[model samples]
Target: MLGRVNHIAIAVPILEEAAAIYRDTLGAKVSEPQSLPKHGVTVIFVELPNTKIELLEPLDDASPIAAFLERNPSGGIHHICYETPDILSAAEKLSAAGARILGDGKPKIGAHGKPVLFLHPKDFNGTLIELEEV
Candidate 1:
């Protein structure tokens, strides 16, 4: 049902600065910024040896990251993504187990162009969980 950790997403006020910090300060390989309108975020991935770190910025005022920034100001960890061999089955199992899925309870295209679904934070000890199809 669950695989390796996919990526850790961090919401930031500025995408470029966050990406630069990873690239220059941490000496990491960073990918180009991509706007995910459906998710209302512009993201850049810092490619690491074992996993990636996603830096996300709000695409608009209505973006969820914008709301997160309002509370955090400095921004913070947005979500942790985990790879899943079968998202639909995983969703079913999670649902049956009383875990609430966010949004319409359907998988959407993620940053890697894979099917992804988000679980509610309350169900996961205040941490938002993202399941991405492997």
Candidate 2:
């Protein structure tokens, strides 16, 4: 079962501009910029009382997030990462339940170097979902 919501990651063409909207208009304070060259995306965390919002933008065209933005031009919510106690078990259940996994069984290092896996949008009512251990 899906546990807590880890964070909502939004895909943007420009992380700074998107971050500004949360900081300027919404008044959500943001963290320092962090670039994950491995993932080819740069992320900025918007801190809130309850949860955080991660604004992610591609560093290059080869970035998977870049591909996601091109396919979904609206570019709002990219993925919902749910916190799980056991990532492997969670991913197994998802696969057994017929959810197509985008990244296979391996858990790649995600934000903060935590293990993460991706489930295709088709399996989640067209919403991309990620599983991460808390």
Candidate 3:
């Protein structure tokens, strides 16, 4: 049901600073910041040879990233996304297998403008898993 690793998401206290580290220090190609209101995050993607790294900053105080930042002021890895050929089928299978889906248990438009769904971290060894339709 899963394809290759899509992108690993990191929640940061400040987006610009994080992007600068990846761009200036690591010499990576970082994409322009894009606000995802639905997800309550402003993101910038660091282009890598094999996979991309998604840097997320909270859009507002109520944003989930804001809550994450509160727990870890320095910020940290938030989630790992995996590509899926068919998200609906994958969601169905995962549900049947007793894996809880986050939110309304429906796919949402992700950073790549593709259908995506998040699975409960408890079901995935304490790591939030994002399934994005490729």
Candidate 4:
């Protein structure tokens, strides 16, 4: 049901600073910031040979990432995304297996403009899992 690891997301207090670290200090190719209003985050992707690293900053106080930042203050790993060949089928299988899906239990358009669904962290060893249809 899962393909390769898509991208690991890191919630940050400031998007520009985080992107700078990856771009300047690490010498990574960071993509331009993209605002995802539906997800309530502004993200920038650090390109790598194998996988990408997503830096997320809360779009507003109501954003889930804002809550995460409040808890950590310094920010931290938010979620890990995995590629799935068929998100609907994967969601159905996960649901039948008793894994809870976040939100309305439906896929949303992700950063890559692909269908994505988030599973409960409790069901995945305290790590939020994002399934993105590849």
Candidate 5:
């Protein structure tokens, strides 16, 4: 089962500009850019009091974020991550419940170096959902 909201991800055409909005304008504490080549994204985290905002930009044309940006030039919320006590069990439960998991249906190392799985957007009200093991 899902736990607390981990972070809210927003895809941006330009990571720097997007990060600036949160860091400069909003006066937030933003982390340095971290390139996740395996995930094909470069991310920056905006630290929040209760949660975090993840800024995602495509690492290359083949990146999923690139496709998302193509469809949404202005960029927007890409996904919402929720924590889980056990990802494998969570995946199995969601799978048995008929929710489709993305990719190979296996957990991958996320930005926080924690195991994570992505559920299909169609299964979650058109919003991509990421489950991260806590």
Candidate 6:
């Protein structure tokens, strides 16, 4: 079951600078950086009312966020993650219902140390869909 949107991830090239701006300038207190090695991103999260704002910085060329930043002149929203109680089951249901998943089958640990899986844009009608279990 999709519970709610946990966070909106924004991909950027300079995470530290962004963190400072959001914290000092914008007054959004952010969490400590957590490196998501699997996704090649170092993330910093800012808590909100019903959700959070996750700042994602690419660690290398292989990082998907790198390509995303390159494609868009202005870095922006990368994906919106919906929190699920059981990610595996949710993914299975989506697959059975014919939604295309990008990977081989299991949710990988995302920026928040949560199990996360992404539904293909082709299947999600251009808006990226993410399932997260924290």
List model 4 lDDT by residue over 1-134, tens digit each: 97999999999999999999999999999999999898799999999999999999999999999999999999999999999999999989999999999999989887678999999999999999999999
Off by over 4 Å in 3: none
Per-residue lDDT tens digits of candidate 6, residues 1-134? 88889888898779998899889999987999988787688999987767889999999989989999999746788888898999888888988999987788678876567888998988776878888895
Query: How do the residues 1-134 of candidate 5 rate in per-residue lDDT, one tens digit apiece?
Result: 87899999999999999999998999999999999898899999999999999999999999989999999999999999999999999988988999999989888888779999999999888999999999
Estimate, for each residue in 2-115, the C-alpha lDDT of model 2 and write its tens digit. 787888998887788888898999999999889989989899999988778888988999998988899876567888888888887877887788878785567777767888
Question: What does the lDDT read for residue 113 in candidate 6?
Answer: 72
> 15 in model 1: Cα distance from truth in Å?
0.9
Error of 1 at 50 (Å): 0.7
lDDT values, one for every candidate: 0.92, 0.84, 0.94, 0.94, 0.93, 0.85
Q: Is candidate 2 or candidate 5 better by lDDT?
A: 5
Cα deviation at 131, candidate 5, in Å, is 0.1
TM-score, cand. 1 vs. native: 0.94
**Per-model TM-score versus the true fold:** 0.94, 0.91, 0.95, 0.94, 0.95, 0.86
What is the TM-score (0 to 1) of candidate 3? 0.95
Cα lDDT for residue 52, candidate 6: 88
- At residue 42, what lDDT does model 4 achieve? 96
Q: Write the per-residue lDDT of candidate 3 for residues 45-79, one digit (tens) a residue.
A: 99999999999999999998898899999999999
Residue 47, candidate 5: Cα error in Å is 0.3
Worst 10 residues of 5 by lDDT: 103-112
119 in model 3: Cα distance from truth in Å?
0.5
Q: lDDT for model 3, please.
A: 0.94
